[model samples]
Target: MSHTQTIPTRSSINPADTWDLTPLYRDLDAFEAEFSDAESQVNDLSSYRGKISLSPETLLSYLKAKDKQFLIIDRLYSYAFQTSDEDTANTQTQAMKNKTLSLYNRFFASIAWESPEILTLTPEILSDWYTKEPELTNYRHYLEDTLRQKAHTLSPREEEILSLSADMSYGPQTVFNMFNNADLRFPSIDDGNGNTVEVTHGRFISLMENPNRQVRKDAFEALYHTYDSYKNTLAAMYSSNVKKELFYTKARSYTSTMEAHLDCSNIPTKVYAQLIDTVHAFLPSMYRYVALRKKLLGVDELHMYDVYTPIIRYDSPYIPFDTAKEMVLEGLAPLGEDYLSLLKEGFDNRWIDIYENKGKRSGAYSTCVYGHHPYVLLNYQGNLDNVFTLAHEMGHSLHSCYTNRHQTYINSNYNIFVAEIASTCNEYILISHLLKKAETREEKAYLLNHLMDQFKGTLFRQTMFAEFEKITHEKEAKGEPLTCDTLCSIYSDLNKTYFGPDMIIDEEISMEWARIPHFYTPFYVYQYATGLSAAIAFGSRILSGEPSALDDYKKFLSGGCSMDCMDLLKSCGVDMTTSGPTSEALKVFDRYLTELESLF
Candidate 1:
């Protein structure tokens, strides 16, 4: 029998199996009512427009009102987006999602005056206001971070104009999403059993891990060939997106687009450069890992298609979604009882939408609604990898849960800089547990290979992507053209450099940049690399019984945007400013590679 998992339609699935979105709204009627309410609130925000700078009390009032408005808006968005994601082909839901997004953009444009108006206040005046209003202490960090960008902040009218155009700014990504998710179709190939299977974004990863190289290569070629056919359009979309970044940079008085993005989280450009530098310095480790993979696979020359396949295949059991939940609970036991209890509560309360159905969104993510439990969406496939994804996203869900419970709404939403730390920590912790509990050499080797893959994918590959982003941005800044051929050449060269001499850098891999959704969001991919480094270091400390490590980790989760990303990591005992964390993560990868070699 073929090892293919059949995906079902949304209507065919049990109601109990889907996420209970009631926490967000009672129904679409309630959602419509809330939408109207949100619009009214957006109109009301103008009342405080000219009054925010008057006094600390007025500022507090504005902040509180805005927070309330945002909460409703968030809930509305979460409901719409998640509902649409359940089945993208549902026209009604997609329309609702589009309307909600438009409302969100309008709300954002309405409040664009807040930042510029707040920035208008003198430092001493703002400090005096802080002293005058004790309640203002709750938003001190928020205000400070806003003021930190005062140099880039434009006049109130200009800021509002920019804010109103925010929806338009997401054009590139929106186009990519529509094309990749809804329109583009992949050709079917035989799964070695005389049965034809169509390629999908969700199933592509599974197909790559197939033992048959022909299937993997066919899938890779088909996926990229489709992307290549639209290379000119994609190139235009990506270039426009990069130029958009440049426009913001120039509009905000920033030196570069990268500086603009990093400054949002108050991260220095040095940190970004250091991440790339540190990873490049450890290229030999990655090269050795690739060499080992080639040796283990018995391939004379490893190609991009072979990268994801398991060298030492394990005859693992099909872990059902319920069993996966239990496994996550067991893997996370090291985090203490309260954490375990909360995890169980999430599993019990229908916080998750598990399994893939027709037109369902690919991959997993955890999103937040202020007054409710964090919601997670998963395309569970009854595999061990799916179990890890469960743990990873739950880490995000619980982080949101903890943050919302402790912090005010204004301080509740954490920055993306620390977002991946929580998720990847869960992944590493689970991997560590599974490694120790493996009953056979094959299992241990499989787990070890998984670790190596994580390092390669997250650390090395992301850094390479970061480099590509930096280069393309610089080229665009220097008035160089970013055509299809240019992007492919740049990306292809980086592939050769990273994969080393042993691996064949297929031309199809050049178009890989066009396929990545993250490239549209410049400087975002590097966080995964930085995040994994911090997670590995923190996981080591906690598992080794470092004092106050768990407490500090929990505190970091709860801190939300109350502190800068670096400070949050520092509080958790990993300083990202230096190369220490990245170096240590590389060392951990080396250790895993050694173990995998010994086991093999």
Candidate 2:
């Protein structure tokens, strides 16, 4: 007997496999009604703009009303985006998402006088108001954060002008997005089997992973050379982005772009520097891993294109969705009974949209509304990677679940700096469980390879990108031109440093920086490195049955933005402000590399 599988339409999908969004809204009519009411409430916030500092009661009332309005808006936005993601081709949902976004924009614009007006009053006055109106105590932290920006806060008119420039400031990123996604093109490459395959942004990584060296080389060269053809134009776009960062940095009275970006989350500059220094200390381990790749491939010279190809080949059995769930549950048992119970609840309830369907989004994500259980969207294919992805995204959902249950709406959202920790920590725990259960050498080796790759890609690779950003921005700040040559040279040198002496730094890799979308976002890539490091540190302690490790980690998960991200991490005993967590993470990488080397 033979069977064929097909992607189902949204309406045709099994109800069990789809998320129960009725928890958010029962029908379109209900959503529309709530949305209309929320819009009215949001618009009414403008009346409280200048009256924010009127009196204690008025201030408290405005704050409460604002939070109430936003909570409704959050639910409406969540429902619209989740629905749109279910079937991107559906015009109705798309329109709904756009409408919600417009209202969201208006909501922020309506409250534009919030910070400046709040800053007009001194901290002592607010503290007095807090005592006078006990209810104002609830927003103590929120008010403190606003006051923290008093030094950087401009006059209302100046602030309004800056806000007006928001759309104009996004010009560089918009141009790059259009050019990279729409206009940029690459030539077709011959597949190892004499088939021609077009190199696309989506397909480039898969091509680089092709077992045939010639195919990998072809894809790498084709993609980079096409980028190289427009190197000057790309350089200008990146330079413009850097200039914009500088403009805002100076405008906000921040000493540098990194300072301005990190200030938002109260992160110290030392944390960024510490990550680079710690990663540099462990470059030898990365070189050893690179050497192992070269030995496993039995190639005299390993090129940049060769780095992504798997050193070991194993064809594991197809994983059914049920099996994936079982695997995740078994793998995450180290997190204890309460965690497992919640995981099972999410599974039993329709909290997850579990499979691919026609017109659905291609990747995976976890989103939450304040009062509802978090929802995870997965385009689950029956594979080991998909299983890991399931574990990863559930980590995010459960994190939000814990936070929403514990924190108020105002503090429920965590910063992006610590966002990936839960997800990556879940990944580490799952991989550890799988490693313990593997009965065959090849299986163990394969699992070990996957674990090592996470270290390489997340910790090492992202830190390198972070360092590149640091150097380029510093040069631009010093009035040095970031021409195509200068950018390529800096990138090429960093690649050689990170990949070590075993790997050949191909000329094509020099143009690699032009293709990175993250660089346009300033100093954001460092968090991927720091998040993984913190996750590994926490994972180690929890798995070893360290006392209070599990409880402390749960506290961190429930923290949300209730505290500074660094303080929250520190309370969990993984202080990212120092190099200890990153160093320990590197040590684990070294241990794994040793074990994998011994297996070979």
Candidate 3:
């Protein structure tokens, strides 16, 4: 039987299990009407085009109008995007999503003149205007941030051309999305019962953890074999993607693509550098973990396919969706009554789409339309990982809730730099609680092993990816063409270095670079490492009874771009500038390793 048989169509799924986009728009007609109105607002922006710097009054008025325009367009896009994700096969919803994006592209082209015009003013003049108009205080950070990029701000015509290119820039991502989700298909494999089962990206994870070594190897080989066939196409697509980054960085006169991407969040390039360095220094722990897995499984050699299967069978209880919610509530109790109450409100109000459905989006995400409560999308499977996913996504939802309540509309959206902290903190706290409540030695070992895996996947693997991106981007920065052979060689070497001598270092692993979507966004994966590190620091503090720790964390959540992301993290007591938090996180990982070894 096909595993997807258990998945339901959008119409067959229960209403309560899906999110209510009604909060965003009452109906499709409402969404259409807003789209029309937002287009009008975009046209209206022309009136303020060259007049943004005429006076403090003009700038403030333009900013307010811009905020209003964004609010409407974003809401329209959010509704359409979620509707399309509800069922990717729905052609009408997909058209709406496409139309919404087109409108955004037009809107972006319209406002492209605003930045360069604003840059026309001197920094001193902008500062003086801020004092002259106290209302600009609401957007002081936004204004100053704009000024900070003055050196990189292009001419008005060049900016307009770049803005127009935005729509086409998504070409590589669009191709990957279509291929990964819609076109790609995997062949069936034997289930050890003489039954053949079709493989899916989602089911591949479970198959890798199957006890039968042949089953795991078959799944791995089948999946990568499919990818290998398309390696040339994928390499070409990714090459174009990297060249686009190079184009933008060189166009804007930045030193490198990594610097350009990090500049958006005002994060120091050194943070990215140090994360890779620190993880490299501590890689022996990763090797040791791999060696232990090899010994426990009694396999002569550990292959890439064998890495995910648990050394100790968890035999964890089958947690239904509702029970998972209750467990999450209990696990997150340390975050205090107000945060808990808000979380409860989200659960009660249908803020989450809680299960997988055929043609629905494959993974999890939390998105907030500024006026409405935050929305979380999940493909809950009732496993331990799903339980933690519930807690993890709720972390994002509550962070949105807190920021929406505290910050202005413009400032309501937090930066990606600090976005992952709350979600990871929730996961850590939930796992910590689970470990404490584990009754048997096997259960405790399972939880500890899960923790170790989390460290491996998030910290070590992501850092390795971060390094790969750094190398590739730096290479391209020096005018090196990222051909298939070059990309594969660099990726293969890094995989071997990170996984150590124990792993079989399958040659197929080299093609892994063509598969990671985040590579489309250069330098984006390192945040997972930093986010996990910050979570360990923050979660440990609150759990260890550090006074006011929870409050400080809440403060960090409530701060939505009110300050720089790095500074906001510092307020929460984790510094990414140095290797301190990353070191502490690795120590935590080592402690869990020691515990898991002792349990054996």
Candidate 4:
């Protein structure tokens, strides 16, 4: 743990201090009224079920009605999920999540018309309909993409039944969420002064940065040991999610489950393979960075536990939430005036719940739904990382903000392929701004080390997670079961390869998957790596003080799902279809390694 880490000063700034949801509804009563009206509206969906294809006009109207219903559901569910994540055991909030989810399931199951019904349309008929209907004209791309997946779609009835089972379908994610928040208890850790500090998901990373070696080791063991106790149960839940993926892929008759998943987001499988290949080729840079860190800390050797130690012992500058807001806006000035204004609106209007409060959720993220101001959830400590994190999440929030303003409901939601660009770009901007502001060599070195850590975690570590996902899916494809023992062995081997020969690779590290929430979503974590790679490419362009780069990056933020993910990146001037971004971004990593080693 970084020893300079401290508890957030504004930990008592509860949810009521921010979030003026009055624009969405007057109060909880108003929200309930809207919720009731929506449930009643969706109940009428079955009336037009058989008649959707009577004419193009009729089909277009049905689609609009369906989208309208989804709009209401989106608002309701977004509020519920955000509030629930804040405090998992809050009975009222939990009830809202359940209620909203059930309503979502019902509406989706009742009106699963768009995909299967459109798949039956002849190209000529669809083209004629698009020309005849104004609504259908805007939906041309959306409909075309759905039709392309006709070969993988289930029959309408089966699809509807499955849509109805979404609550059950999300079993693994639900279990993992419960375990993460409510069930798991961590052992206590001793800080630098030997006082017992409790281990928490939020504090674990903080403790990992301790100057004292024993504290880092104790915190690491305490956290993972708790996870290890439940590894088998977590493994079974994880394996079930993987099995669910396999079952869906087989049912759809797709070539592989990966193809089945990518179809949903309109991305190509080549993008995934390209990321894996590029990162694998660049592994030595990451290894070299680790070796440099080992030398800087003056340790006899660096173990897995030693990776987080701070190279500079000076106190980090404290950045409160408001100051951080200004810094974020200043840092992201390259994204153009319109984007900066929207992010500023969030800060002024308290769209951010920026500091941790009692019972508030751990970690940080940007959560958005169409037609509402995007919300950021953070347990903000006044640290440099928290400053950068604010910038990162606001990237995602404004991406949604712009898309909602520009596109129709269906097109506003972007795929994961380009999602990380905004967030990672903000990170680069924050670091660049700070590097410019540094007053000493040690400060610059500390900032550089932190940036290096992000590069390693976001690019290298995520790629490792991605590889683990690929192996598990491939193993399942071969009709093999993924037991706890098998997963442990695979994870341990990966630690050896990625951490390299000099770094101590512990065997119990195999239980790492037990702590990763991303594993529940099969093949989903690779986007972190690809996103950072793309961010580095695009961020480098804009930060170089290039006017065209600023213009291109803003155009990309406004894109949402207006273009395909790969094409969207091409618009921003990076090609996800190739390994160029990953390789080029790794070269930046190599430069940091060189700088870090120079300090040695």
Which of the numbered candidates is closest to the native, going by highest TM-score?
A: 1
lDDT of 2 at 80: 93
Query: TM-score for model 1?
Result: 0.97
lDDT of 4 at 506: 64
lDDT of 2: 0.87
- Which stretches in model 3 have alpha-carbon errors above 4 Å? 1-6, 193-195
Error of 3 at 275 (Å): 0.6
Worst 10 residues of 3 by lDDT: 1-10
Error of 1 at 467 (Å): 1.4
Model 2: lDDT of residue 599? 96
Q: What is the lDDT of residue 238 in candidate 2?
A: 97
Candidate 1 per-residue lDDT, tens place, 354-413, comes to 978888988888998887888899888776678888999999999998898898888889
The lDDT-based order of candidates, best leading, equals 1, 2, 3, 4
**Per-residue lDDT of 392-472 in model 3, one digit per residue for the tens?**
888998899899999999888999988888999999998998889999998888888888888888999999899999888
Which residue segments of model 1 deviate by more than 4 Å?
A: 1-6
* Residues forming the 10-long window of minimal summed lDDT in candidate 2: 1-10
Best by lDDT: 1
lDDT of 2 by residue, 1-600 (tens): 323334478899899999999999999999999998887776687777788888989888898998888888888989998998787767798689878877776677667778899998888999899889998887888888999989998887777677657756868976785577546768988878766767765456667767799999999999999999999999999999999999999888889899899999888899899899999999999999999999999999999999877788776777999999999999999998989998999999988898877667656789988888999998876777678889989999999988988888888898889988999999999999999998999889989988888898899999999999999988988999999999999999999999999999999999999988888899999998999999998999999999999999999999999888988888889888888889989999999999999998
Q: List ranges where model 4 is wrong by over 4 Å.
A: 1-17
